[model samples]
Target: MIRKLYVIITTSAALGNALSLTNQTKFKRSPVGGIVTVRAGYAQTPFPEWLTEFTGLTEWPGIDPPYIPMDFIDFSKVPDYKSYPQGVCGVNPRESCSFDCDKCVEPDDVYTCSKLSQTFDDGPSPATEKLLESLDHPTTFFNLGINIVNFPDTYKKILDAGHLVGTHTWSHPFMPSLTNEQIVAQLEWSIWAMNATGNHYPKWFRPPYGAIDNRVRAISRMFGLQAVLWDHDTMDWQLIAEDSNLRTEEQVYHDVQLWKRGKRGLILEHDGSEKTVNVGINVSKLIGDDQLTVAQCVGGIDYIHQYAQK
Candidate 1:
């Protein structure tokens, strides 16, 4: 499968800790929250194609004791994930574990909940415009920074419609394969783009392909993002029906209907394409107004933006 920005959170795995300073930028000190002190890691000139206007700096102090990386990361970049070595996934305990791989570790990354919930991923897409139009209540959309840039007007419309927005990374790359620094670049850049575009700082972070682990989780936590996974997956990305999760239109509708109220839980849907968008509309209707946004379903946090999430 192409896995074009698939859903859910997975175990985080890393190739190595060695950061290549070949093209790294200069930095200086900047303190945050009085408790944590960090410096900015500026993006290299002629930055990565996915670079946003917040190209000033991407900073996260190395994972050291008593020094937590600040959540207010205004930096940006999409490090080439393929350039890094593919670490030994769930295969090696010493190495990282990828959600895409078997034997992977699992802990955080909200996959289930008591109340029913709905969340869309890899969007602000062309088709998502329709999805937004169909929403009756506050919904949560995990948007891609690239899509936000491509569909600036739609991105703004999402905010205007009162739907919650979260970061799905700058350019969707498999998280487990990226280094800690590279992971920081992908996440910070995406966060900066959303903040710059909508004046919104999303607290929810859904790793591409459900890929996350201890290292990935730690990095995301520093930036004040909660990684989300899913218990129910409609697999709306699968065009043809091979199985229930990978079913087509009618099957997907059947799949949605299968989830009885109070029984069904947090599901992974997409607005990445027109087909998915059409299904999303029906999914919402089928799930009904009782369905809560991820923020509400996973309630505890007061507001959507950065605050204290318990």
Candidate 2:
């Protein structure tokens, strides 16, 4: 292994300005989107004695070598879609909503106090990594719709990152459109592929296109997975990359406005597409700026299961 050396320069020290001088070196940029590399030089003499004598930053005992990766999305480079995801007409996600318990009934089936758990679908791609990194790794869980048979590394990365990997129907087919056995196969194959990563059993299932019926639900339940459906969908996937004219940001903002008006369960989002990531980022910032608290549903799945029992 090549040993690495690090030098720190405090912001207020005599030699503080000198540290910026060393950043002159430039490196290659990633051929793929939103990633860059940098070059660095280290001397065996320990960062020139003159620099260390004046700047405590150079002498800090606890200073360690940089290990953080330099991969990130430049959202600016990501142009607005020529087309945008189809906006929902008539219905707003916010407002009163009803919860269905397969068995018992609650006195008040609909309420506005509930919180929504947001989960990204159809990902494990570079876009997924970028979005997750942007969020600062909040406790928000992901229902990764991984087609692991193709991208094994992505499947491994999703599990390694501690996100929930779920079935997206192996080939991204609609669940309701398939026969019962096919649905079971889709669920089973996803689990099998996911398990190969490290014996992780998925506890969630997101039907493609949010198409789930009783049979789909039953198949999911049989696999010990809860059927996940999005309560708020901005239709980010509908955007066309080549269009020069399209959905307005106001329309996206309106979707969020709708979300704020309703009771929550799952906020449907897509992780595989840039348009989706962009919208998610916008909503996150809006929620933060407005001082709205996004609920951390630590026991989201449990709550759903328990609610079902009641």
Candidate 2 colliding pairs: 8-57, 82-243, 94-261, 94-262, 95-261, 95-262
lDDT of 1: 0.59
Backbone clashes in model 1: 9
TM-scores of the candidates in the order shown = 0.67, 0.53
Error of 2 at 293 (Å): 14
lDDT of 2 at 301: 39
Off by over 4 Å in 2: 1-113, 137-146, 241-246, 261-265, 289-310
lDDT winner among the candidates? 1
The deviation in Å at residue 164 for candidate 1 is 0.8
lDDT of 1 by residue, 1-310 (tens): 2122323331111212222332111100110011111112322112323332234334322222122144453224322223222333443343344444442434545666665667888877667778888888887888876566556677878888988888887766666666666777777767756755676677888877666755676678778788777766665655422223423477656655666544647777877777777877887887777766667776745234642222
> What TM-score, to 2 decimals, does candidate 1 have?
0.67
In candidate 2 the C-alpha lDDT for residue 30 amounts to: 9
Tens-place lDDT per residue, model 2, 60-131, is 121112111112312233222121112222222211111111111122111111464356666645456566
